[model samples]
Target: MTGRRGPTLLSLGLNRARDTVTAQTPVTDLDEQTARDELARLAKVLGGANAAYHTSDDPVISDADYDALKRRNSEIEAQFPGLKRKDSPSEQVGATPSEGFSKVTHAVPMLSLANAFDDTDVVEFDGRIRKYLGLDGAAALSYTAEPKIDGLSLSLRYEKGELVQAATRGDGTVGENVTANARTIHNVPQSLNGAPDVLEVRGEVYMSHPDFEALNARQAEAGQKQFANPRNAAAGSLRQLDATITRARPLEFFAYAWGALSEPLAETQMGAIERLNALGFQTNPLTIICDSPEAMVAHYRDIEQQRASLGYDIDGVVYKVNDLGLQGRLGFRSTTPRWAIAHKFPAELAWTRLDSIDIQVGRTGALSPVARLAPVTVGGVVVSNATLHNEDYIAGRDNKGDEIREGKDIRVGDWVQVYRAGDVIPKVADVDLSKRSKDAPVFEMPHSCPQCGSDAVREPGDAVRRCTGGLICPAQAVEKLKHFVSRSAFDIDGLGAKQVEQFYADGWIAEPADIFELRAKYGSGVQQLKNREGWGDKSASNLFDAIDDRRNIPLNRVIFALGIRHVGDAAANLLALHYATWDAFSAAMRTAQEGNPAWNDLLSIDGVGAVMATSLATTFNQAAEIASIDRLVAHLDIQTAARPDTAGSPVAGKTVVFTGTLEKMTRAEAKARAEALGAKVSGSVSAKTDILVAGPGAGSKAKKAVELGIETLDEDAWLELIAPL
Candidate 1:
């Protein structure tokens, strides 16, 4: 219910304050610190969700849940504009392309759409568009309304009226090339007549309900796993490495939009869809032009009513400005277009009894509470478990001691309302206090680890309680080892999560270093791995080979594999690039633990916050962790972080900071361009900063840079300097 877009999506606005807080807190009530923390958590959660949905063709969270969190993040950023994070969700599109497929760079970025949850939100969306276009309430504004297909986005490129290539929208800018598999889709046309010389037709690749059910029946008969949903099935079928397999599956395409065109397709959005339909493409029949917001909302309601009978799944309805000229004038925000919005259907709710509350410790030692529910059908799925978020959630209080759920605590044996909307795991929406028994016990979080009995401590300004046992705890240790071999980490082919658990249970591999020692210890002896129950001689040999392959890993991968608290792949990459080498980074961490200047150095590296730095230092300073890391390093070759090809750029290897309002582009774009040219883009201007790009109303950072005698350049000068490329 708040205004969505800010002037800058990724700019480090005013001074940032940091504190852990829950997403349930109202935007109007949140302080700057809480807003910053909420943004950080949202960024991480959304990043992981995007990767799960796009890269793996599997979603971890439901669409409704994701939208709520994203909307909360946007509202918070709107209130505390200066606290926008560099890794803000508004700056990210889809996930990075997965492996196995060749990469393709989209000619035009495939951005996502903002969501309108309710009728009021939709009305506000229309109001925002009208206000932006200088139109009053009386001004006529037509929009194209259509079902937002719950399917994978695909772009088909045709040159000279011949189908050339097709790509999946991966991270918006770069995508995965699925040309062969796309050609097998029944609705896809091999050629286009009366089309532009070059055309990039954008649309959704989906599976109809009949097709999906049939495929699942075939899969069950063949002793294979049934698909979770139609969307996943379509994505998996289209991304098949074997085109023959894709041909065997039922997949369809619905052309709805255009990306790049040699000439204009149409003057209006509805006209463009008609033209695409004429050009041998299957456009949605439900797509219509609405003269007003009321008409658009009415169409959305009609579509929602017809959702069950539509054959294909549609999570929401999308409304786009019909006039091409007005759309161009509206332009775009960082990750979404201002001229369009998705009006989503409400989440489905069902009442179920809360069986019990269970605590599960993660790799990072945080204790997560889950609600065990009686089997109930919600949105066509039998959901027996729901996320409780944290202990505060169960206690009906947020991290800031603010009341939530009307200050009603959830209790076991109570009938809870579960809701599911395109979610793999449903959540408890409300507690039925009338159904609760007087003898029902209030759920309480354990002060000790359930797995290892380690002292569970909840720090100030932190939401979740953490086990202090470190690597000693069995749950944390096993999960940490699993993280070490994840796809982005060492990625030992023969050693997956199952294998890691087995090896740990067998007392063969304890830490990451133990993996590299397997060949030397168990290659030829009576205790060989070939003698194991599941592993064969060839499998053992291959496992060793895979371990050997990762002996020489990149610094970023190494840092991520360590699984230090608060240090994810992005943070690891930043640290790796900042330090360049493992020795420099490790030594710096060690020095920083002694309360020296190295602490400031670590803090100065843009994106490395105090909490993350403390975690790094704590990991390095711990004697047990150091020994483990030393052993691991002894068996591996750690490569230095590689720099971009900066051949002649003057700013290459120099630390540059941008401050205040930028006129040329979004702050994210400017930072990306600078990094592409091999310049280090830092958030704060420090003594080590080589240049400061200052715009109007440049604040403390600019003044500090001036006092420090760092080279200062305005927007025009900075652009000119980096223009020659």
Candidate 2:
């Protein structure tokens, strides 16, 4: 990997003797096996880098280089999200706290920020925030854009205007208490004025450029190793065990955020930061209100231009929703706020030669084409594979009728521009047509599934082309099995995606029903799951118990676990309410072919439409599908679906169909009244129909009701029966 041409990925210290077989393999172009291999290496590298920067006051890589490593790791995790290792670097926040400090557990966690590396990401961040708050695209949103300090995050607690505690933002939950070291810093006020009884000020402890250079000069004269950067210097100075030594170091603090407050700070983000500044804390002076992405980006650019002269290091600009009320509504995801994002400057981009194009099947059977590139460095990370969203993305057109890549189609053997940013997968931003060979191949999409040889279909108006093989395809089968035990489905403990995939590969389980018979089939056999690698006796026992716990599943879980098309959790719940039980729903679906009366009954369910009804009918009516359903049902007791509390309503859970004109009540009025009592009002009478109301001029419907042996009532009788409710 490192001859006269110079090293690429192997230069990142990932070089290995065994890795020489395919030393050119790009980090981004990964199979599960290789991803695991690369993730382990990255974890070790990043952990060491964090320690060297945070604890030792030394660094192996520049801040830009370290960020790129994290970004590359994030990209790999995104590609194989389900295969995330336990020791993945993305899950960690910072290095371990230095010894000799008392640990403090924060009541409210100090979370991290998700990053947006380019203008497109900034626009997307705004859109995602609006979507979460149920705001329209045209809605006016105010945001506060501030410089993101490249320093250690610290939390300072004040009790009735008196400084009480100080700690680092360690792992977002707990940290080492550095109250003594914090008091030594001049910027950290020992007492506050006009502040709440309890307030926790969260900010960054940093050193300015002049102070950093001065401190390094002093260290050099004292015959001590100089610090690498201001951030490292500030972190090391603040965490020192000796208070006098920390007091001698020149460090500063800027209040940007808070953790806990007894009283209201302000209505908006800008107001709160201003209040903090008024309360004798130094907040970043460049903080400004930006009402739109254009304003935010303008401010970001201004900060980037002035970055060199700011005297402190700043990696990016942080934009947060201004209104506290809106922030509460937007809330948090995992460890980051959805309402806020760190909009960094555009990452490094480089030209790489296109190696080839490969089509891969996703969990949903969508055949996504990937561009395999010749290994090249982009933004300090090795670039190998870039996502070609679909045939159109490869062909340079978006679904919205806009031209991307300047209306150019990417061809094999062409030099392409690869762009990588924080967490986003590296993409072919543009193609270099001048470098394209005259005979470069134009990639064509396959008509059949690559895995199962089934028809691959691109539905009308859909950007993605999907395989139609259903459970027959191994990819679809494994994904469906994974979905069945997903958190929203059966939620069988100890059974995750990895386990499901392994079992499927080993032929231990092929479908949902096969999971229940594991004990009977392999309990005493020579081939047993407990005997497999990465499995133990206790793990096998726990898995079996977990499976047994879900034997009697709720109807909604059952419906969701089936992985039916167009029937999500809400639709499944609606079907569960209307049918009440699996047997009832299955019988109705078996009888519902195309336009049968049972099909109409299924369609009449609230939220159930033609698309969902047709898909459900077709799925349940298939002989193979029904047989599989029957086998799964045989091992357990099927719990009846619970309806919303309607015990007081006399007509609750009743199926009523009205026919002909009513004398007392209008047909619409009668239907509304029955539905209000939780009754399923149908347009046609079927075997499932409980009662049919007949009136004057009733003809075919009345005779059909009688033929079906459904109880019939007159319009007056129907009015009287419903009147009691």
Q: Which candidate gets the maximum lDDT versus the true structure?
A: 1
Per-residue lDDT, model 1, residue 163, is 90
TM-score per prediction, in order, is 0.50, 0.46
lDDT, residue 698, model 1: 59
lDDT of 1 by residue, 1-725 (tens): 11111222223321111111221445776667645755776787667667777887765555555566677678888999899888887788888998989999999999988888889998999999999999999988899999888788999999999999999999999999999999999889999889999999999998887788789889998989887777888888998899999999999999999899999999999999999999989999999999888899999877865665577777778999999999999999888899999887765655668889999889999999998976543443445688998988888888788998789899888878777533445787787687689998878899999999999999988899999998889899999999999999988998899999998998988999998888788755324777888778788778888888999999999999999989997799889988999999889988895357899889988778888998999888889999999999999899998867889998988999987557688778899899888887888878889999986545567668879999999999999998899
Residue pair clashes in candidate 1 = 13-82, 14-82, 62-423
lDDT of 2 by residue, 383-473 (tens): 5688888998888899986899889999888778777643247788888787688888787889899899999999998788899887789
Ten contiguous residues with the weakest lDDT in model 1: 14-23
> Cα RMSD (Å) between model 2 and the true structure?
21.5
In angstroms, give how far residue 449 of model 2 lies from its true place. Answer: 71
Candidate 1 deviant stretches above 4 angstroms: 1-223, 229-345, 348-351, 375-383, 417-427, 524-539, 643-674, 679-724
- Model 1: how far residue 127 lies from native, Å: 23
User: Local error of candidate 2 at 635, Å?
Assistant: 92
